[model samples]
Target: MIEHKDYCVPADTWAARVAGGDRRALARVISFLENDDPCGVAALKELYARTGRAHIVGITGPPGAGKSSLADKLIRELRGRGKTVGVVAVDPTSPFSGGAILGDRVRMQGWTGDSGVYIRSMGTRGSLGGLARAAYGTIQLLDAAGFDYVLVETVGVGQSEVDIVRVADTVVVVAVPGLGDDIQVSKAGITEIGDVFAVNKADLPGAERVATELEMMLDLGNHAAWRPPVVLTVAASGKGIPELVQAVGDHFAALVRADQLVKRRLAREKEALLLRLAERVRREILQSWSQEELARLWSDLAARRLDPYTLEERLYSVWKGAKEA
Candidate 1:
């Protein structure tokens, strides 16, 4: 268990190390936080003030959409331009091990020894919205560490992956051929989140068909400040990566011109603040109640003697009492 006295210290030290460009410290801090260590959160809070400096790019799509391959290519392209990159690959949790497999590392070996690039994998941990506070915190750490670009790769299913829109400065939605039904499903989650679309594996027969379908969909959507573009790529062979990178850069530049980035950042800040407040209340306040008190409350609730609103009121009262104590 991490003691309160030791909590702030590791966090502060790790924040400083990240600021100094210590890769290992950055990795360690992220790992610690991914495991929900309290000290890690403290360290993230300490380092949070230093973040919001890097460009955050989120890549998401359906499973087997070749998102990892596309990300690997994007990293290489950014590196070639002399830009330092940080990648956070969010993998699905294995029910048995309860840990991220980091399977995408197979294609990402190109950046293994490159000090200019930092890569880390994260698990969903049952966070429904693809938005893990830990992943967001890791991005902040990389941003504070002075990385030019930070890429967030999320598991390509459910509403959670689409939540990347709230966190990323530029969002890339990847899709593949023969996923006709997928495009429809995507409309519900990711269709609007994209600042750009990537039709990866352009060598495939149905690539053009997929591209045309996506273009038609985008054309039918409500007009925005900037229209999202679709780019084709065979990521394995590095085809069309340059165009993809340029599209990403151009989209970011347009966001700057429209001054929408500021609005997005503000909204993100508000959401993060509320989440932290809720977490604090749940932990320091609600948990202070004795088991007997909780059992009695639940018993009353089960008996329908207490409605949800009343229960919430009681919970808040308990919280207030704990604060006073």
Candidate 2:
């Protein structure tokens, strides 16, 4: 974990700044979240009540599908509608630095001056998945900071990208012409997950054919009530953005009408709980064990005097909330 030891302020102070729309303060909290700081956790508890207002939209697809360009365009259009927007981009890891090489910020630098728009790029940090490990917590922080629309951009690869469904309220899967099935995007899983589809780079030669393919794929889907809409977009020039936003709005409206929004949120939070537990336990559980107990376990395992099962039982006992060895 990279510590931003600069943050010595109280969690409540950061919480106030976040609720008041201080971008720097919000960014600090997100950094703390990635580092798994107790201060960050405390701040989230302080501001958790202000959450559940932002509409989380996930943008994902195969690489070179212009997903980042589309996300940049959406931020512009969403802001034009008087909506405050937050963008969480899960970028590929940098080999040397092991940090996020930001693609979205570079494309959307025009909005950097606008305080209403907050964009964060997160690296996968060696975690093998389409998103940064801390992406879910980052979204909650943004929501509590009062963003009206939060757009999460996935690391465009393949089925690993389907992790977006764990956090997003409405998901947009972007695709381009000439992308074959080589990416191993589990066809059934992809179809069921996308709430909106965009055939980006529509000016390309095979755009129409690709859109048609998507339509046929949509027909095979088992989505009830709300069908995913395929919209063509030249994301670079901002074409078809309004219609795409409306498509997202339509899916969200359907979820609300069916009273499924709360249900989905509950499910997401439940999953988040498991992920958080896994992260925390992996990081701290072993370190918290008594050194004397660990030394005894190692000695017993090496001497061939005690069986491995007995040693395992001792650790299992500690894990089940026993303080004694």
Candidate 3:
């Protein structure tokens, strides 16, 4: 029961309820984060100090690679070990509605009654990096809510999907067999971010070959400190899930032992800070501005009457005016 004024939870009360593991409170805070509520920001500022406890595992790979199924199995496996889990499932947004059509909740409905697991689905919402604008904040809220693990599942994979590596403690890239040239998971840029590579759908043909190829790629790469392991997983049947979980733990342990965990955490903080600052600056720059003005600017640029750089300078001048006003 969050004490609220106009649907906004009080900061102290919000923190108290979340700390107590109240599900409703947690959901309300999550909504606040999703909606970009000021109250949510305040609660986050208070709860921020309590974060960084949960291990964030990011599951990302190409479409149809069973990333969601793997995430579901991983949750079960984690719960078997007496761990509570939180999942941030990123789904592609509907272009017209700007809402997630098949968010993780629809697929993971079985866990709806489970007390040890919490699942949240976010629409990509036009965000380019396969994450919602509020994702970083959501993870911290989950951490402050006392989840043992926070798993982030990206919408899909590509070189740009590497943003997951910036936030997750361990990144597991899931791949399937039979895609020789169309292997999106193993692209040179995408391969470098994976802490562990999984050849999923092992029941299918060519799984072994995919695993072998991943291992060979790892061998060729200059991963001086640690070589990412390629594991076989049939996510649908739960095959190799235990081993995959172990691999995730092993990678985390390696990071810890090498004193690299703090370095990654530092990088995550830097990224979050920059992201927030940039968004804030942009929002303030456009506050109360009309769409017509922007459209006119675009039209002028399209007509080549105004160069982009000159328009940007003019926009900055408008921002300065707004700031002073």
Best by lDDT: 3
Q: Which stretches of candidate 2 lie over 4 Å from their true place?
A: 1-9, 95-100, 103-106, 126-133, 157-162, 181-188, 282-315, 321-325
TM-score for every candidate vs. truth? Answer: 0.87, 0.83, 0.88
Order by TM-score, highest first: 3, 1, 2
RMSD of 1: 3.2
Give the Å error, residue 187, model 1. 3.7
lDDT of 1 by residue, 80-119 (tens): 9999998887665532112334654325666778999988
**Candidate 1's C-alpha lDDT?**
0.78
Relative to the unseen true structure, what is the C-alpha lDDT of residue 267 in candidate 3, on a scale of 0 to 100?
A: 89
Please report how far candidate 3 places residue 34 from its true position, in Å: 1.4
Which residue window of length 10 is worst by lDDT in model 1? 92-101
Better model by lDDT: candidate 1 vs candidate 3: 3
lDDT of 3 by residue, 218-277 (tens): 787898777898899998899999999999999999999999998999888887788767
- Among the numbered candidates, top TM-score falls to 3
The 0-to-1 C-alpha lDDT of every candidate, in the order given, reads 0.78, 0.77, 0.79
- Please give the ranking of all candidate structures by lDDT, highest first, separated by commas: 3, 1, 2
